[model samples]
Structure formats: C-alpha cells, structure tokens
Target: MSIIQINLTIAQMLDYTMPILFAALCGVLSESAGVVNIGLDGIMRFGAFFGLLGAFFSHSPWIGLLFGIAIGCLVGALHAFITIRWNGDQTVSGVAINVIAVGLMTYLLEYVFSTTGYSPQIQNYFGAQAYRVHLPFLAKIPLLGAFSNLSFMIWFGFICTVLMHVLLYHTVLGLRIRTCGENPKAATTLGINVFRIRWFAVIVGAALAGIGGATLSISSFSGFSDSMPNGVGFIGLAAMIFGKWTPFGALGAALLFGTGQIVQSIIAVTGIAPKLAPGLTLILPYVLTLAVLAGFVGKSIAPAADGLPYYKEQR
Candidate 1:
C-alpha cells in the first residue's frame, strides 16, 4: 500500500480498537483477581443499552456514560453475589448473565421501542463528532499523527491500561488481590479477605466493561441497537487469555483484533471478492483467537484457583 493508504489504515485501526482495548482491560482486572468474568459480554450489552437510553432521555452523552457505569456496577454486584457469596459456578453465572442480557435487551427493544431489535435514532447522542487533538509539531508526522489522533475512548483505554498495570503490580491492594486469586487459603490465613477481594475485582471489572460498551454506543455508534456489542466481549476474553492476563499484552491483542476488523471492513468496501468476503471477514477474529489460544495454551499459566470457589470447610 502507498504511504497515505498505510496511514489511513493505521488511523482506521485506532478508531476501531478503543472498545476492544477497554474490554480487555476489564478482563485483566477481573481474571487477575481469580474471578472468571464470562459475563463480560452481558455487561457490555447492558452498558451499551443503558448508555443509549440515558443519552436518549437526558439529551447528554456524559450523563449516559454515568448511567451505564451504574448499570454495570449493579450487574457486577449480582454476578459477585451469585459467584462469590453463594458459591455458584463462575462459568454458569457468566453464561446466565449473557443469556439474561440478550433476552432483556431484545424484549425492551421490541416492546418498549416497538421495534424489532433496535431503538429509534435519537438526535441527542454521544460521539456524534470527531474529537481532534492538535499537537503542534506532532500532528505533522505521517503515520504517527494518523494513529495518535484518537477518540476520547481510545485515550481513556490507554490510560486505564497504565493504571491497571500499576495497580496490579504496585499497590498493597494489588498484592492482596493477587494473593487471593493465587492462594485463597493462604490469603485467608494471612487475614486477607478473599471474598471481598474477588467481589471488588469482579465489580470493578464489570464497571470497566460497562464503560467500554458505553464508548461503543455513545462515541463509536452514537446510537443504540440490540446486540450491538456483537462479539467484542468475546474478543476481549480472547485477548485477555492471549495477553496472559497482562494489561499491556491485552492491549496489544486488542489492537491486533481491531486492525483485523478494520481490514475486513476495507476489503468488503473494495468488493473484490464479494462472495467470499463476508464469511472470511466474519471469521478473521475467531481465527486469530484460536491461533492465540493454541499458541499459548500450554505455555501460559492461569491463577492457581481461577475457576474454583473457595469454601472454608472444604479446606
């Protein structure tokens, strides 16, 4: 590709990547704390839905974002209550959340909106305009400038990644969370609150996921649609696994997946191989996901008691 073409591709990739990056960050927080958040998909769905709803009602996107975060926290709490408090199976709880979100969103869309599966276009929406950052000499750079001029969500995701890395590796709270995940028995013996740590992590992770979803609805799409998150949550999960539960690694994986998605869209627009394009583009992310999983399955190690529920009597 020519220089301009390459720059454009990079720009497109950056624009498309913010949501996945945010979701991956959320996964990192939850899984690192030994809470397997399979319900990330559901969390994203509710975030997007409520975000749009809030924007529609309030006529302000920022308010919608807050609303979305609130909704995410509520869902996260429910997940925590089931998985941690009740000692329910994490995988099952996650799956249940996903199923519930899908059905609930569909019902609201059809019944409340009187639409099949999408809400009517609301004039008041978030991210309706491009947000440009003019960095004196930096904006003149060829590819760098193109990639650097990112949306608000992109910048937020990057900052969250740094913050998460620091929090996971630096703070005493981080140590406690890690200990709980790695060795609940030991953590309990040391007077650390294992359930509380897991609950905190799970809720925080859900909030981040909600923010990610809100970004997509308010900033990326500027509207609400049933099942709008598509499979981005699943993609984030794949990224978390591929990154070995590290923020930077997950960011890299999110970028890779995002770039693949942009490339697929570009190919579809070109209409070169129209017949095969749809199927090929749709499977690209999953193909990459499989590749990553296969590549690291044996080499990568998860937290010691990742999916197991802790019980004092069992120990």
Candidate 2:
C-alpha cells in the first residue's frame, strides 16, 4: 500500500483500538487486585448511553465523559459490594450486571430519547475537526504520519498505558495491589486493607471502562447506538487474557485486534467483502481475538488469589 494509505490505516487502527484498550486496562486493574469483572461490557454500555445523555443535554462532551466515569464507578461499586463485601459469586454478579445493562439501557433509550435504536446526534468531541490534534510536521514521516492528526482520546490511551505500567510496576501501591491479588492473607498481615484495595481497583477499572464506552459515543461516533459497544468489552477481556494482564501487553493486544477490525473495513472498502461473504468479513476481529486466546490463555498465569473471595474472619 501507499504511504498515505498506510498512515490512514494506522490512524483508523488507533481509533478503533481505543475502546478495547480501555476495557483491557479495566480488566487488568480489577483482576490484578483479585477481582474478576466479566461485566466490563455492561459497564461500557452504561457509560455509552449516560455519556451521550450528559453530552446531549449539556452540549459538552466533558460533562458526558464525567457522567460515564461516574456510572462506571457506581456499577463497579455494586460488583465490589457483592463479591468483596458479601462474598458473592463474582461471575454471577458480572453476568447479572450485563443483563441489567442490556435491558435498562434499552428501556432508558426509549424513555429518554423516544428511540430504541440510538440517541439523537449531539455535539461530540470525537468527530469534530476542532477537537483533533494536528501535527503537520509529522505528516510525511511514513508510519509516524498517523500521529499527525488524531483524537485526544487516542493520545490519552497511550498515556494511560504508560501510566498503568508505571502504577503496576514502579510504585509501592502497585506492589500492594499485586500482593492482594496474589495473596490477600499476606496483604492483610502486612496491614493492607484487602477489601479496600479490591474496591478501589474495581471502581477505577470500571471508570476506565466507562471512558471506553464514552469513546464510542463521543470519540468514535457522535451519538449512542443500541449496539454502542458491540462486543468490544468482551473483546477487551480477550485482549486482557492475551496480554497476560499487563498494561503494555493489553495495549499491544488491543492494537492487534484493532488491526483486524481495520483490515475487515479495508476489505469492504476495496470490494473484497462481497466476494468473501460480508458476514465472515465482519467477524474478523472476534476471530482474531479467539485465535490469540486459544494460543495464549493456557500459557498465561493469573494472580493466585484472583477471583477468590477473602473473608478476613476466616484468616
């Protein structure tokens, strides 16, 4: 392909990768602190609609972003309460959240916006030319040209990746969180509040998932659709597994998935989708995710206490 084409493809890959990256990051954070959050997708859905609602009503995407994060925290807290506090089944709680999100969001869409398909188009930062960061000097630099003009979230995603890596590896808090995941009993003996750490992880992770959802409605598109996340959250979990639960690993996995998505789109645009069956073409990203998981999930090891409920009293 030509240089321009390569640049455009790279840019599109980053655009598509943002949500999955955020979701994977969410999974990494939660699981690293001994919580399994299968409801990341549901949290994204909640963030998507609420983010749009805030942006639509306030005419400011920033407010919408906050709305998404707030809802994510609330839902994350619910998950933490059930699993960490009450020692409920983490998987079941996650599944319940997903079910509730689907039904509730559909109902809210119809009730609030009078449409079940999608919300009305709103002023969004994602698509506006004014919101993009333009670096004209970088435009002619081959692969780097992709960075010439891009959404702020795209940059933020990369920054978050670095920050997460620092948080998980270079900081004392990171060490403590990892310790909680590996051995909550040990963490407790060291004066660390296991429940509190898990709570913080889940809530922050969910907030990031909320941002991922907002990226869909406000960054990648102008409004929220019934299928806002469209399985991106689950794919993110796949990315998390494939990445072995590391921030930079998640970033790489997300980019790989994003590449699959962009390739599918390119096939469609290049008149190859019809010849190859459009349905099959659309499944490329998922197929890639499964393939990666099949090869990596078995080899990857999780934290020792991950998904286990710790009752301090038992200790």
Candidate 3:
C-alpha cells in the first residue's frame, strides 16, 4: 500500500527468490550440457536429508553442507550412468531417481533416527547471523538492510549465478558443452567428448541443487523434514523454461515465481478474499508460467540432442 510496505515486500520476495534461483541455475547448466535433468527434485531431497544428517551428527551446519554436496554428486553420477551410459530414457531415469530418493530418504530416516516423518531440530543450523554483512549505506536503508543480512548460501547462490553465466558463455569448456548439446554428432567430429561434458554438467548441476536444498534445511528451516524442499525443485524447472535457459534470465524468472509464493502466504495470513485467495495464491505460479509461455510464443528450443543418448557408431 505504501512505499515502505512495497520495499518490505520486495525484500521478502528476494529472500524467497534465492533458493529457487540456485535450483534454476542448476537446471540451466544440465540442460545446456545436453542432459534434461528432471531429477532436480530428487537431488534436492538428497541434499536436504544429508544436510540434516550431517548437521545432526557432526553438530555443525558446515559439515551438513559438505555432506549434502557429496550426496548430490553421487546422485548425479547415478543419473549419468543410467541415462548416459546405459542409454536409458532421460525422463524415465529422472522420474526413477525421484521415486528412489523419496523411498531412500524415508528408509534412512527411519533406520537412523527411528523417526517416521522428520528429523529432530538441529541446534547448530545455518542462519542469517552466519553470513551477515554490514554494507555502510545499504544497511542504513530500511528495507535494503534486509538484503545485507542474507544467509550465507543466498550469497553463494548469487555468486554462482554470475559464475555460471561466465562459465556458460566465456570458456572453451563452455563452447564444448554447448556444442555437445546442440549436436552430439558434430561435437564428436570436433573431438569433443560429449559424454564427459554431459556428465560434468549433471554433477555440477546436482551439486548446486544440493546447495539449494541445504539452504532450505540448514539455513532456512534449521532442520529437515520429509517435504523440506516443498516442490521448489519443480518450480526451478519451470523457471528454467520461462527463462529460456539463461542463468540471469532464470534468476529473474525465479524471483517472479518466488514473489508469487510469498504473496500467496501473505494473503492467506491476512485472511483477505478468503476462499478465492487460497486457490489463486496456490495456482498463481503455474498460472503465471502459462502466461509467460503463451506471451513468449516461440518455438521452445531445448538442446538439439537433449534427452537423447549418445552411442559411438560401429565402423
């Protein structure tokens, strides 16, 4: 309603945007490298679960982050092995990974903690205080102050966004990756190892997704739950599509979706428009997704060889 209120809303939106931005960045990386990684949801779950496990056992959130990254890499490798090496359908493999993650997490939680649904509260979870920065003029501003006091992973996410953009556009490796995605046959002729690039992308993307999950469980919630990621992974995929596969574009799309999510929660809290508010708030992101897709009105171009397996031909 007021300027201050608007600023505060924007601040809150940024907070919600960080995690999705990280996840979408990961999606961009994998897709750009010719791997359609629909299993970001599973990778995120692995990160959240392992983050809690590591934090609980080691009594340090940093350890949880490291563990989450390790788990994510493992999951990524598995995905690569099945889809890339075995020539399994990428979409089916991704779905299988999601299902497996759900089952594995449930089983591990029950076996280790003897808890059925969730883990115990972590006392040493990551928080804003862990990454607080006091920018001179920025901190002095009312709503802008919130930006300076962001969580450590949120800062890392932003850095990763910039780094990914550079890596995707500037480096020789980036060219190779794009080449592989655009035409594996052509890339092979150029002596580029398509499989290797795809594998690298999958692992990198999974690692980022893991960080996003750790941000949720350790930094955002200070504990892990069964639904810790809460569909943020899928939201990230939508963001990737909406952004047309660019890092900065994905970040913008993520901000928009995150704003929708926060607005939904705020409206529910305010109890304004009661019945319609709930449905509208819940469906807002998808509705906006559809609108964006419609308005863009272009052939949605994925990697030319995306979702396809590469096999060396017999001479």
Per-candidate TM equals 0.90, 0.93, 0.91
lDDT of 1 by residue, 25-98 (tens): 87888887888998998899999888888887888877888988999999999999999999999999999999
By lDDT, the best candidate is 2
Give the lDDT ranking, best first: 2, 3, 1
Per-residue error (Å), model 3, residue 95: 0.7
For every candidate, C-alpha RMSD to the true structure in Å: 2.5, 2.1, 2.5
lDDT of each: 0.81, 0.89, 0.81
Off by over 4 Å in 2: 269-274, 278-298
What tens digits encode model 2's per-residue C-alpha lDDT throughout 1-315?
678887888888898999999999999999999999999999999999998888899888889889999999999999999998899999999999999999999999999999879789986566577778899999888899989999888998999899999999999889999999999999999999998999999999999999999988988889989977889999899889778899998998899888877776677666654556556655765665566557643556678898999988785
Model 3 TM-score is 0.91
Better of 2 and 3 by lDDT: 2
What tens digits encode model 3's per-residue C-alpha lDDT throughout 156-190? 77789999989999999988888888888888898
What residue runs in model 3 are displaced by over 4 Å at the alpha carbon?
1-11, 134-137, 268-276, 294-299
Ranking by TM-score: 2, 3, 1
lDDT for predicted candidate 1 compared with the true structure? 0.81
